[model samples]
Target: MTRNKGADSVQSEASAVNAPRMTDKDFERFSEFIKREFGIKMPPSKKTMLEARLQKRLRALCMNNHAEYCKFLFSPKGLESEITHLIDVVTTNTTDFFREPKHFEMLLSSVLPDLHKRTNRPIKVWSAGCSSGEEPYTLAMVLSEFADKNSAFDFSILATDISREILQRAVNAIYSEDKVEIVPMALKKKYLLKSKDRKKRLVRIAPELRKRVDFRQLNFMEPFPFRDKKDVIFCRNVVIYFDRPTQNRLFNEFCLRLVPGGFLFIGHSESVSGMNLPLRQVAPTVYQRI
Candidate 1:
């Protein structure tokens, strides 16, 4: 017996209600823009944030709202460097020091100890999609404690992001108390300097930690521009924006850049199980290059 057409129609209607109201054209524009500017793959759930960010842009430009802005975006001048400015305006970057505590705990308890035992050379770490400097700075602080001033087994951290504004802010290393509140008191005292001025209620990362980290601008989808095999990479949360195929490509590239036995830390919601890479699962959201 054939299924009833009405039943299928009812099922389709239910799916529509659960789905976001974003149109295919709107999603397509946002996807293309994000891919070009930040090497991020756009997930379906990002429709709300993208709409909210770009809606304000539309109002600012005084164009015919999102529809007109979309058309203008496809114009000759729109696809140029203007796209970078667009992403800087719309994408949401939420990060904090030791944001995912487990990853850091793993690093301090297990990963660092092993790396230290193996070699006396300064460890090299890359914080791809470093986003506003928290992850890299956290890496620096942990490595500082772990390495213990031998200076031989010291560490250098390279943190990169696609946003120049965020990069500059990351380099500034100054943060409001609200942002730094979650950091432990001992860590806060060690790695952060509290501002005393009444006008500026902020904390700045200590010079010692800041100097160990090098901040640069990098788009991950492009070729691997920097050369050393990375000992550790914290690329968490960034890839959730990417589609499956893009995620696969990124994992492949990461495998190439990571040293054997190097660690790749991803967001709690991300994994590489089906990516067909040479990485072995170490923990939830953590992988070791095999």
Candidate 2:
């Protein structure tokens, strides 16, 4: 009465489809863990969304249902292997090269010149939550342009994300041609390399610029591993997922991590008003460390 291998897989798929929707209790378990471990708020409204996202993982693991997935996710084995992946899946990493263009304009106009004048040391810029490498590579091009003009100006870029999966994408520094259209033509000409296979329509950040950025995995919920303070930090659009207290604490840490007179760039849609942090609003969604 044993089923054939194909029959077993078909039955498995059917059972997975017929599996009960994630229960209220299971959703709470996931939401609580996400909030505690990643500082990401997963309200009840996100239950359906979370359920959908995790379904793929079940298939990958050959799991039949949410219960089995939850069992493994809470186990110690999951902590080592699945925790970060869980966090990664829940995130929607929407980013673009040269996004919020005003920030770069400010970088060229004030942040760069000011920081460079303050010290002869290589200017340190950290692109927190840098998704798929756009922000950091854009930085490389702009900073390189500035250095060409000012022989004495030197800089370093640190780009980090919570997802190892996304960090790998950043390190690869490759993008579809469309992913880079926002990049200006002259800069694109200087900093992007076309794929050998033209039909693929792919481009990679020039090797020279790729060498300038160091990509790493960083979770805001963990202690920051900075050995030296940063001169400028771009954490734009990242704190919105955190609750107010988490956001406050995270910014306070960013405040402490910056050298005085350093810059912090947040998302245009986000605000830090009324927080007692030592930052002054210098432009729309841009702040200077006091």
Candidate 3:
């Protein structure tokens, strides 16, 4: 037993010592690869983050060093998997239910009602870059409330992300109490139910709410396939990684996707002042597709 324990300890030490040192070159390669593939620009300052996120992938693949991983990624045969992994690791997805509350309030109080009145058809909302599904689920909860008590304004929530892995998790629609704490109390009662298992103090979204959202893997650089003129599109906290030209193109695409007078919500740090899309600023980080 002692011999086996010592051997395991030595193996662990060896693995730690052989782990890849993420240097400037590796960081540049990651940034450039993402840019070329997705038009997403990751700054060199995110080297530490690159290490942290990619280290998981290396560990999964049982790679001892970044050199071998980099070689594999650069090889023609490995390019497809490498680009998919790049999208999974490089895109930052920090979101929650009802994040930036004021925006949701605007969506609930204004956007849904106006769109419902305008078109006899369903109000379509797209949660672009919907990390792990909280945003779209939250949207469904609000829309459900509106639809139940009020007119039967049809609605569908489309949740999309570049990472299939994350999209799968989003489709699962399970989250710990810690993640759902920011969800308003009323919504908590209306849309979520605690799991019977005590080990997991998490809640599953109510089926009624979950049914309203359709989760899909979508890369923003490509032409969006959905033809439904959207009522509101949420692309929050996502564009800061893109270069100015990419952001300009993204805004143009968003304008094309939105119906006239539909809304576009961006990250608080992101703005379209100089890009000059038909969008008019309605609030900080919010615009109307005019």
The ten-residue window of minimal lDDT in model 2 covers 15-24
Reference-based TM-score of each model: 0.83, 0.92, 0.89
* lDDT by residue for model 2 (129-192), tens: 9988889998888899999988789999999999989889889888999999989999989999
Best candidate according to TM-score: 2
Query: How many backbone clashes does every candidate have?
Result: 2, 0, 0
Better candidate by lDDT, 2 or 3 = 2
Model 3 stretches astray by more than 4 angstroms: 1-18
RMSD of each: 10.0, 4.8, 3.4
Q: Write the per-residue lDDT of candidate 3 for residues 177-202, one digit (tens) a residue.
A: 99999987988998899999978898
The per-model lDDT (C-alpha) reads 0.81, 0.90, 0.84
Better of 2 and 3 by TM-score: 2
Model 2 spans > 4 angstroms off? 1-20
**lDDT by residue (tens digit), candidate 1, 92-132:** 57899889898999999999888877777778898988878
